[model samples]
Target chain A: MSDSTKVRYLEGHKGPTVEIPTPEGVPLRFTVASGGDRAGAFLLDAFLIIMAVIVCGIVITALMVIDSATASSLAFVLIFGFRNFYFSGLEILWRGRTVGKRMIGLQVIDRSGKPLRVEAIFARNLTREIEVFLPLTILLAGDELIPNLPPWGRLISLLWVMGFIFFPLFNKQRLRVGDLVAGTMVVQAPRRTLLPDLVEEPAEEVASGEMARFAFTREQLDSYGIYELQVLEKILREPKTPAETLLAVSERIAKKIGYTGEMYPSLEFLSEFYRAQRAYLEGRMLMGDKRADKSVAPQAGKPRALQTKLSGKERSRAKPSASAEPLQWRTPEDPPQAASQAGDPAGPRVPPVPVVPPAPPTPPADEV
Target chain B: MSEIALKSTQFRQEREKRWRELERLVTQVEKRGIRSLTADELHDLPVLYRGVISSLSVARSISLDRNVLEYLEGLAVRSYFVVYSPRRRPGEVVIEYLTHSFPQAVRDLKVWVALSMAVTVVGFLAAYGMTLSNLDNYDLFVSPDYSAGRNPSSTREELRAVLMNEGEKVESQSLGVFATFLFTHNAQIGLLCYALGAVPLLLVGLLLIQNGLILGAFAALHEQKGLSVELWSWLLPHGVTELLAVMLCGGAGFAVGMAAIFPGRRTRLESMVVAGRRAGVIAIGCVGMFFIAALIEGFFRQLVNDLTIRYSVALITGLFWIYYFGWVGRKARPA
Candidate 1:
């Protein structure tokens, strides 16, 4: 690998950076995307909640009007079950991406940056039953029963709740136990470039003088045609590149074009050009990860991996990766052989009972 | 771009950021339920997202091309007045606070009225008993020094003639002047009863009760003397505005005391502050009532020497004023 490419790759390994590119001279600054767009999600959730409440209200009213104790109790349970089923089912099925998340450009993916599959989604969402729902139910019932406890059971439950509730904070990735067990991560949807590449029709005559002076190489320009070239450009144009190297690259490009002028194309421009060219040769397209290997042959010692290697700490920290292999959540046909193996009888053996209560519509007053 | 367009664009950008942040929050909530967030995390969400939106708005505003400033100003104003304006719908906190208690503020007000009415009934019966027994006449229910007369019916008539002749210029300089001479003198006693509420509520009620008792005695005496029509003429002219004022003042005072006594979540002092704000508004309303009473006394009462005209005018204006200020005023446009 060229020393320049080595320098380029090293920059990317450092830390998170904005990859979105805008026109030159336009100030590219951090802009908060609208949380309001997610207002719809809140609204959608709220609508569902309101509907549920209204339905429950009507049912309660009807029951009261008729004075049916048994019917009222049944109705209450049914409503509770319905809410849990939909809320948990949607979250798991969609891999943490709710209707709201989808509306607002977000998704849930696994650690490897892949959409969460069914098993992971189920595992993560099902925990809602034990961690949130059951605890609340038990607490309500417990309070009703003991009237007053020795404070031990209450304390234990309180600690268990307090401990689990704040679980997301301790981890950098913000994973709770469900997230950890399910191997999931919530991520912002990768934004697509607004402008597509301009097809370079045979130019009539390169605009005279300064314009033609820094004309991009055919291969270099072609990088812009592919979406992934922007990523490569982002990686290449780093502050760490020596000024001398940039000047040298600029000189080479200028010399090839046979131009001379009072001003020279900036080293940043040249570095970006080379980066784009290299990316084009590698055949990586925008947002396409699998095709990355075929496009660019990995030069020995370059470690041209799709992404930076996991940090040493991360690798060591990962609890012996519960293998990527799918665990059985019963398909209609695949009944468990015995409940032996993982000893997780909490699996397919327990016929799926409704877990979460139907989510009440999000209140408009809530900041959430 | 025109200034409005520029502002609109800026608003749009800020809105977009909020949407993005909300999207992020929802994802977080989905991955982890709301209970899972630490208090700090929960707190941070609003603060961070608010910061992000503000920063974006500032950036967009600064970046705006000056050419569009005027247009942007217009858009901002329009949006301020029209779009993005807060709905007047009752908020959850307010609704819950108002409804949660079984005996609401309005209900309590009714209880006060009932108590005042009871006081009036008992006062008249006591005065009647004194007259029937021919006791050393305690007719007007005031100390002999304050009493203008034991003949309540003719006393009322004489008071009316005095009001007509002297008009607004004739208020007694003494404190008792308001309770005694004014009580049977003008039918506007009702308006005074309601209006005095603008003061600390205790004063308003004391004035109302004092007036009600004296009037009860006077009316009972008038029945004994067989000069009820003469008393009615004297009482009706400005009494409507007076009575309405008293009730409104009572309502205002009740509001203040209630706020002080049961300040949910607020310190008693804080509740007093809120109640004070509401009282200030009601006081402003009382000023108008006072003016109306003064008008009836100065001009209308002078012309309507006939008892019938005075009574009818008082009755109509009294009812209308009471309905308007008491019920309608609650729904008045918030300043």
Candidate 2:
């Protein structure tokens, strides 16, 4: 297979199981998996950049106030010492990313897809200083102090400069000394999909055909029920899986569920299944599983307006009686009763508490 | 058989195509976003994005290193002063002041050369003209002390002997100083002449004329003396080198003066500046000759005092230097 084909295969199999091929060798399109928002990262980057510029300005002004020779020497030391620091501090501290990768919305992650190891971060930063910055800076500084020293000083300085400037020529990661020592890689930040709450409408572009290419068929996609699919779809969009191979398992389960058609289960479905399947595997299926039915009930028949709030006029209340049943059903008017039942011990473990903010009212087109 | 062969060829082609695609894909992923490519794309990423990937790849090479920045800086400063004539900025008051003072140096050199020649000429004229007019007055003009010391002879012969021996007793001790002075003075004059470009041409022309007259008078005086050979012998050993040095200096000064007054296409200051650099070369050459003159004066002239022998030696030395300088100067194209 061609290289692009290999890339396409990974895109197809990974995460939320987006089929993602556009068509016939065109731009490879995949359903977007759930990813993290970068507003925080952007703010951090801006802060770091401001700090570096101000510090550099202060140094430059101070150096200028001294003799020309001394000023030049200072410039040499600072340039060599701090070029890598700027990139490293900004990458690891403020934005939690490197400028090069950040500009493109990428983040560096470990093999396990966790935040970078501090040691690796510092090592990489140090290496950049060692290979390019330090040697060249020393040469730059040395010549100014002892100009009459033999050509040896000059020759070494030249070699150092050449090595650094041409560093990009031979690096696979476009990394100089720092990158080599650190053993880190730059990768794009995965994009996020905004999922509305139960009463709200779905986002306009769900990238339907992309998720269908995974192992599951269309019936399994719909059969999984809209709420599971909706939650699963939202989960698929998360940038990192935290755990690997979730998509493959989801596809296998989706295939076993009597789903036979073109549309496959999305990352959204897999993540929800991953959570709910844990309960099922641990023998926590409710009698008839009617509670799961209730959570997904209001989403049926009208997927478009799922973003909207359910009206208060229709309401119901169900008392939680201590009964061990495989499943129980709740009417559309009794969402709170289902919610209370879901909180029970035998039920799928609810998240400790909802950390995500409640869905806001749909704003005017311009406001959002 | 043909079908089998065709199938195998197709398979080979497919494999090769895959490999190339893979390389390109890797390269692309490295430079741009890896997410920009699909999983299928990444397998061939190295091949497709070779440039990008290789750029990221760190390779090592060995070679000689040079500090180009410092080298350029040194060249700029040294060459600016040594090879090029210094110039004040256009409309700078300094240029005007330099121009006014520029001729003084050249004029001073011219005056010294003229004064020496004047003494020689007046001595000769006094001897020659007085004898022609009246024998008795010849003693008063040439000086009774002059021939009193010479072997009894004609007024011209007596004057020639006096001129030949003039400064002879002090010659050995003063030879070094004289030679050095000649070398330094001539070199300095050449520099001044070249540098005077900041001033008017008239001053340089006057300097050249004055030096030329001095030389003429000095030579005519030798002819007036009956012992012309003796006089030539005494002076020629080093005089030729010394004269050449003076003339070259005068030429440089004249060049500068003319450049200042009659700058064509270039501003007066600019032309004078250009001439100054070229003139420096000539001035340096003049200094080298002065050193040769000093050598001759200190050792050669002092060692040989026989009237006939000294004349021949002086004549040969004079002719040799004159011919050499003229030939070399002709060949050298001044900037």
The candidate that wins on lDDT is 1
Q: Write the per-residue lDDT of candidate 2 for residues B116-180, one digit (tens) a residue.
A: 33444454454455454444443343333433543223456455545555444653544554445
- Number of clashes found in candidate 1: 50
Off by over 4 Å in 1: A1-368, B1-140, B143-204, B263-274, B322-335
Across residues A33-63, which tens digit of lDDT does each residue of candidate 2 receive?
A: 1222222443455476568757876877886
Best by TM-score: 1
- Candidate 2 ranges beyond 4 A from true positions: A1-368, B1-163, B166-174, B185-198, B212-225, B307-315, B322-335
Model 1 agreement with the true structure over A1-368: per-residue lDDT tens digits: 24554344321121111222211111222211233333345367647766877887787778767755444544544554444345445665444566666676544445433333443553344344445544554566776645555667766666766766666656555555555545554444423321211112112222322233333333223212222333334433344766665565455444433335433446535543443343233222211221222123222122336333543223322322112323212234433333231222111221212222332343222423
TM-score of chain A, all candidates: 0.39, 0.31
DockQ scores of all models, one per candidate: 0.01, 0.01
Give the TM-score of each candidate.
0.28, 0.27
TM-score of chain B of each: 0.49, 0.46
Please report the TM-score between candidate 1 and the true structure: 0.28
